[model samples]
Target: MLLLATGDVIAYSYAPGRPGFLSGAELLRALPPGAPGAPGTPGAIAVDVVAEDVMAEPSWDMSPSTMLELARRARSAILERGFDGVVITHGTDTLEETAYLVDLLAGRAAERGAIVLTGAVRSLDEPSSDGPRNLASSVVAAADGALRGAGAVVCVNDEVHAARWVAKVDATSVAAFSSAPFPVLGRVTGGRFERLSAPPPRPPVFAGDPASDVALIKTYPGIDPVLLTAVVDAGAQGVVLEGTGVGNVPVELFTTIAELTEWGIPVVVASRCRTSAAPLDEMRHGAGLATRVGAIGARGLAPSKARCALMVALGTGGIDAVRDWFRKL
Candidate 1:
């Protein structure tokens, strides 16, 4: 019941080689010859699979909305293809963003089975290719039996992560893309799957408009309160603050946050470190300070993910409503 939504022939600003980039089709043709497997071979996991290419353009300047448009079409393709799960080959640059959008648009995440997103840090044409291994892992991960009922995830190399937490850590290493602050669900191995951590709760999410102006700001040492105060002044609908370890920020920033609360701008607090993450409702060091100061805990969400949640939540309703929605998601 798994489906593979393959990537388009898009090139990026950082792609290796020539003055420009090559198409995914062009790259695939350039790969070394390998022994092809028979259908449902004992050596392979017999995943109900399909390969649908998306994001054919090679530009790095796509917006979240444009990505959403592509995801929606891919989702439709998945449903039309009668797939219970999906895997996508996409540009690593926006893979995380696109994965989030696919989860949002699908709505039926559970019935859609495990949708895995994966791509190469190094392209296929390169001598040290990662695409074949990545694509194999993506296919295997997509049809993972234990992954049934789980939402979309990003599978690269041996590591598998929740789409909500997956981030690209190394630009050039074949072993790139790691899940921070959160644990990975599993890993692909020996044409089989192995579980690492429990699956996250993935409730169904309805699609919403994507043009909303939600922003993310990191709170660094000696960050002036004026910058945050100005963010509210600039009419930003909502802001997710990437705070320090365990969501801690300066108490003075809390005072500015109070001012922001009075102005009706929602500011969320998330930690800046990858190892230490934000807690949902519980007050840790930084989150408690912000909560005590009337700012909200981003609640188990990465700052970027929190920003996306805030944007969608605000578009659906006000801060109060958005807060409740975030809590449940």
Candidate 2:
């Protein structure tokens, strides 16, 4: 028999402005009849819905403070309310960012229960809407005991990916998210989660909320040095440079990067490419030169995630602390 586990699960929605969007009671009504939490189903999981208006702003409008609060609530649900898992319905635009933030916040508490994020590529009124199916799969993922200690994950199109590596790779396709250079952690098949690969262990969690004064800049041919200085002048406490291959940047920006670090502002270098780690040890070129002057490599993190890590590190400690955190990555 293909038996599915039954437990208490909470679903939080943060998507707004889609036509006839369903959440709360309406969302529960949409779950497939045999799935967990669906009305009239025997042995169904108990689900409580927190509507979008209550939990968050739209994904694009989300800030670090808002995301942190949501993470805290998810943790409380597992540790305090004794819930089996959590599911968040978010906007794809910033879904990866919020998911990653939650992963960071969950930290060691992640071992208690699963935290799964899901969203739709198409709205309810659109042809072949994916929201309801995604939500159902996400709830199942959350309820699965196999997912406990997996940290945060995003479940979409029946695929489960670790929050640390999942990214929004398509704008309009139902198959939108990807975790390239890393395989998915698992998949939802036959109404159950089948583990494919194990995720890496969780990093140390930050007790403080992330800082908002960090800036992310992308380097290009003939990139002006003033762009780096302007953000610092504008009160940016840290910066993540999306540099070229192997984290190289234009030599013209070298002096500005050096100056930022000298002034105690962190300058992290990340690759502009979609895959591979940014070791930044290309000593014969701009990347190595920047490292010599104090720039830190983002390792395997993309710029957006690097910015989140930098913000969290800065929120808790100073430049040396930030350097140490990245060093372990």
Candidate 3:
């Protein structure tokens, strides 16, 4: 396993009252020789560690630039360094987002090897810390040949999820992530990967830094339209609206959506419901009305992932290009 540690709960102190007590390299070194990610064992997977201290911040502090950099490094490890697989230790807070970004960047090149991300819900000092076990499982999964071409995946709590569908559904549970409305790709058990499904292949979207000025809004009953205008006024390059079931928003926001389209700003409507895919023609008032007014339906994408996709689209091309990109989704 080629381990790239970007820091998070997994790298926190093993002793209470001591912050930054351990580096990712140190954590890997602590593993026994015959362990999943350790070296010097006759048949064990050899681990190569790369620790980027600059990116060693908490997941909430993660930014687009950092994510792009991580993607680049992971891509390099696979395409240039000749690694069969790359495993990343990321903060769980934004692990899904980073995993998706990596998947988008990796594109079809993912067929060459496996790219897996994992993190822990509890810090090392906490009782029953899940970091080591999760990391081991991720390493095991990455090294498995069956996962090649599986695209980027998040391996946590022994479950493997495709990057496109995984979401952090719990704040503190060890089993904090899920890929609802989509079955998990597989699982890691007894130090082996068991494949249950395969993820559909996707072409690479863009290779450059994503635009940072995108805005995401979740609508509620009687929500003010001023919120949309406020973001545009503040120079948001694009907007993703998390509407009610089936991507419905209040009829009051229709005019605003039209005006934004006229002004050349892209407005993508996605469902706020956990499992409902946003379908513009599903209703006449909210989703259909917004569609008629020029809002783009986000298809099956979650609001946050839609925002990431929009950012990548806007960075790569013009309004027409953004529309075409969403159309593929």
Candidate 4:
């Protein structure tokens, strides 16, 4: 297994009043032999570590281009090293989105080597630091043979979550990650890993640049049409609208969508609600408006995921292909 560090594994210094960033090498050097085997297994599992200081910055200001590059790197390293799996240590902020992006970008080859995204809610300097244990659990999950096709998983606080379903629900708690409506893949118990089920097949990789232009606009009460117009004017290739219940927006927004589609800019409708989305059937009123205008429905994807998918779709295919892709999704 290969362990990659993005420096968030231990960003803060352990001692109070001392101001300095902890290096990835420092974190790795401090880890103990915490890797545990499956229950009744004889030997300790071994993990290969990447060189330190790979990621220049520990912050989460990673752009779409950088994220896509990292995902490609992970896939290449896994294949070249013939590693069973890979673990990435990232910052909690925006971790879920990064994980989901990787899940979509890492195609068939990556399915053979599962990718596990992990991070800590607290800095390593905190007295209640959970970084080491969480990192260990992530390694265990990545190394599990049964999770070969699980796409990308976020393993933290001992629970294993599918990258698509997992969200960072809390800003401060150690148990910040959760998968709702959809259950977790499994959890680590008594120093052993467990698998509930394999994740769905990895999404097809986009045959385009990772930094494809896409914009996300959240529909709010009294949202201005000019804002939507600005997206088109700004030359965004596609737009993701975070609509209200059942992925509906105001009537004017639907007209804007029609205009946008006419301009060859695809608009994907996604619900602002976190848990679920209603069907965008022709029978529904607000949803039907989108259908009348050829706007694609985001199905159950969150706005962020919708934005990511639209970026890929816009880069690789035309509006029809994008609509069909979302329809299948």
TM-score of 1: 0.78
The models' CA-based lDDT, in order, is: 0.64, 0.76, 0.81, 0.74
Q: Indicate which candidate wins on lDDT.
A: 3
Residue clash pairs of candidate 1: 3-85, 9-24, 10-58, 11-58, 247-286, 248-286, 280-299
* Full ranking by lDDT: 3, 2, 4, 1
Please give, for residues 98-161, the per-residue lDDT of candidate 4 as tens digits: 7888787777646687798888887776787888778778777877777777888899999999
Question: What is the C-alpha lDDT profile of model 3 across 282-308, one tens digit per residue?
Answer: 655434567888888876778888887
Off by over 4 Å in 3: 14-18, 44-56, 201-204, 207-209, 275-279, 282-286
Compared with the true structure, model 2 gives a TM-score of 0.88
User: For residues 1-329, could you state the per-residue lDDT of candidate 1 as single tens digits?
Assistant: 43333443222224445634444443333333331111343434444343334545432555656666656665665567566666666777767766765665666654556677777776545666777676666667767668765666788877888777787788778777877667888988876678899766663365556435666787777888888867666777877888876677777687888877776777888775653333434754424668766677766566767776676667556667666666666
- Candidates 2 and 3 compared: the better one by lDDT is 3
State which candidate has the highest TM-score: 3
Clashes of each: 7, 0, 0, 0
TM-score per prediction, in order, is: 0.78, 0.88, 0.91, 0.90
C-alpha positional error of residue 141 in candidate 2 after TM-score superposition, expressed in Å: 0.5
